[model samples]
Target: MSTATQSSGTGTGTGTATADAADLAPVRTESLAAILVAGERPPRPNALQASLTFGWRAILKIKHVPEQLFDVTAFPIMMVLMYTYLFGGALAGSPEEYIQYLLPGILVMSVVMITMYTGVSVNIDIAKGVFDRFRSLPIWRPSTLVGYLLGDALRYTIASVVMLAVGLIMGFRPAGGVQGVVAGVVLLIVFSFAFSWVWTMFGLLLRTEKSVMGMSMMILFPLTFLSDIFVRPETMPGWLQAFVNNNPVTHLASAVRGLMDGSWPTTEIAWSLGWAGVLVAVFGPITMRLYNRK
Candidate 1:
């Protein structure tokens, strides 16, 4: 079950969106449908095409609900205020100082939260016979399943940009300049889309949308708190520090922090991207499995 990979590169910094071709060597049989008519077989539909169909439908669904825009717009402001004025003095130095540190974390946090909504919406559609309609269509094995996630990546982009704008308005500035800020937000949305594959898998397997919401959150809660999302991981116990050190969210947060500070690091980006690839590898197939079951 493969979806499209997008590449983004700037003048000096060129990032290729190359899938590990070796990984695509064989696909799971469940990622296909078996059809026989008088000992004849049907040619398989391309998964990318199916995924894009899901993407287009999700975009259309978003248009129907104008309130979808409010999530990212309101969520960031509330989180910034709750974390800054409420806990800034105790956690960091001051509200202003903490925001300087907090903005990047919140940027990624917004992406994380936005992905939850994706799971919710997907589960809702699944429960309400949307997937039934989709199943009747000759869609790709994982395209509709994976494309739903890709569509939400656009929402993640909006959520990240909206939060960044709100942070700036509240005196949260990225010292890393415009390009750094762009890179930080881009990686965050990409990472969120990758992590969202976990939620997508759960949503595909779960029966109820509400259960999907709870279970999806149960999985992410530890990932959010145990990482460097709200507080410094260095402050954790030595045993926990090892976990935090290895957390992809921590690497993502640290990389964003580096970009915001206009500092360069060679390794954190790899750690973050590696985590994204891992999530996609593990959960992408699971989503395909559940999607086929439907």
Candidate 2:
């Protein structure tokens, strides 16, 4: 009897210790089903999160699609030579004059053109239901959209440098030196960023990637070619000239050339940036509105 009592008491003590440990362990108040359901809620991105995520995605996409390098690395170089040597004499007085005037315009157009493809990628994701999957992530809702915006910045910078290198190779030196060149690039990039918001809205609004790409051509081509990319607006017809004169792209390109050639036009620069600011004011809200609805 005494032996049995001692054994029973030991078993009781062990059971009590085990119960205490169970009570002290971290508790998950929510069930697995509840946690899983919570994950289905859409993520909302903030500004910082959007930038970082976009930057990462942009870089990774670069890794997977090395073909993108052709655009930034090769196309601009060929374009510079094509416009400066082949078409220069026909369009302008001489190659040197054409190079000086055409450099800034081409640079601005390149960045703008590269960014217009954002809608294609976005619409592709939307069509594939990737965005809906994002909506299910617990991530910040704004992050997905904001990240896309930041991701494109890397390509913009790369494209800018490639074009500048090509221009340098062609004997087109900026009179204002490095600082002027940097300022010119900065102005164009700001303009590109402002322009991207409008495209981004299209991405959210469109149905298929192809449709968005087609619409992109409609918007991008008119904005770029109709500007003073190759020929001066003065050579254009009176009514057509009015439209070119008022074009924001023309003002931005002119300001870039002015800065680079040491013919800094403060009024043009201010007006160009004013245009960028105005675009931001108008489209930024529209993008957010569409993003939320998505």
Candidate 3:
């Protein structure tokens, strides 16, 4: 009887100790549950970091679909070859002279053309419901677009280099030396980056990638060809000259020309920068609004 009582007392004491410990210990609340109860959000990445993260994601996409670079690589090469051989003699009296003029214009057109891909990509993502997941994440919304634009910097640079290299191989020499060439490339990239906003807005507004590409092409074609890209506007009618002079593509091409030729025309550079700012101002907000709405 004594041993039985001692055993029972010890068991009861252990149970009491356990109960006290349980009561004294921090409540076994899940961190998530506690966070939810507190109505607190976990800290998210800052704008720059978030944008870079998204940018990295965009770069990674190239691994899975290397063909995504076809426009940047093959298309630029074909354009360079076809344009130099086909129109070089007729436009500037020889292939050599024409390439110097044509190369800069081609670079501008290529960059503008590729900006549409941004819209197409965004549209496809939206269609696939991938954006739905992104929307749910604790990220700065604008970072996604900024990230894509940053990621595409590589594509723009590659296209520019290819055009320049092809032009050089074909006897197109720049008077601007190394410094001039570097400046021209930098300016081209800046313009291209700003121009991408217009396409991003299109992506937000368009229903499908095809529609974005088609619509963008329709708009860009006129902007590129109607300017003084292939031929001088002086030969055209007065009204056509007026339009060409005012064309933004004309200013960009002229800026590129001056840089490559070592002339560095401040007026054209100012105009190109102004237009880039205008495009970003107009399209950036629109794209963000549409994205947030989605």
Candidate 4:
């Protein structure tokens, strides 16, 4: 009886010690409110800041996928070489002479053609659901589309520089010299920036990237080839000349060609700028509406 009673007393003591140890140990219970509201929230970024941030993101994407630059580099080089050589002999009696007329037009064509990629990019982003997150962000609604155009502006510059370098090497000289060339390039970039809004709208409307590309090509091919990029529009039929005369691309080429040739094409420049403004005014709002709805 005494031994049994001693064993019972020991067991009771062990249980008491375990309970005391547990009580001494730290018991951290985090409050749900305190954890969530730890500190003041950061200030929201303004429109320009958010837009530029997204533009930087687009630049970083090019850095990671350097192949994205092939359109700006190889495509322009090939165009300069192929057209300058092929038409130089047959049309102008020499590649050297033809390049003088062809380079500016080709520069305009190449840059404009590549602008379709903007829509393709938008479609891909939408397909991946990335824009959904962008829409949810506290940012200016149009900033996302603006950021895309800003990024593409760099690509446009790259293509222009590459083509100009090729032209210089191929005996193409600009009478307008440095100032004229700079003005022409600036004008092209501005026009391209406005033109890209059309593609952005298409991107939002189209279901697939391929569909966007197809639609862009269907529209671009006629606009580019029907213009005076390859030959004098006067040589064509009167009906064709009428279409070519009214083509915005023709006016842009004329303006750029005149600038590079050291002549101020005031009328052509005005028309080009007017067309650019019209494109942006019409398509920018449409794109934003689609973007908001999408």
Question: TM-score: which candidate is best?
Answer: 4
- Ordered by lDDT, highest first, the candidates read 4, 3, 2, 1
lDDT of candidate 2 over 1-294, digit per residue (tens): 999999999999999999999998875767756777877655566557656976698679888998967877787787788889887788877898689888888998888887876667777778888888877776667677667767777788899998888888787879989889989888888888788888888998988877788888898899899998878898999999999999988999889988898878998899899998998899888977887788
Candidate with top lDDT is: 4
* lDDT over C-alpha atoms for residue 103 of model 3: 90
Q: lDDT score of model 2?
A: 0.83
Writing each residue's lDDT as its tens digit, candidate 1 over 137-164 gives 7666567767788788888888777777
Pairs of colliding residues, candidate 3: none
Error of 4 at 127 (Å): 0.4
lDDT of 2 at 110: 80
State the weakest 10-residue window (summed lDDT) of model 4.
26-35
Which TM-score value belongs to model 1? 0.80
Error of 2 at 170 (Å): 1.0
Which 10-residue window in model 1 sums to the lowest lDDT?
3-12
- If scored against the real structure, what TM-score would every candidate get? 0.80, 0.81, 0.86, 0.89
Clashes of each: 1, 12, 0, 0
Per-model root-mean-square deviation over C-alphas: 20.8, 6.9, 6.0, 4.6
For residue 33, give model 4's deviation from the true position in Å: 4.0
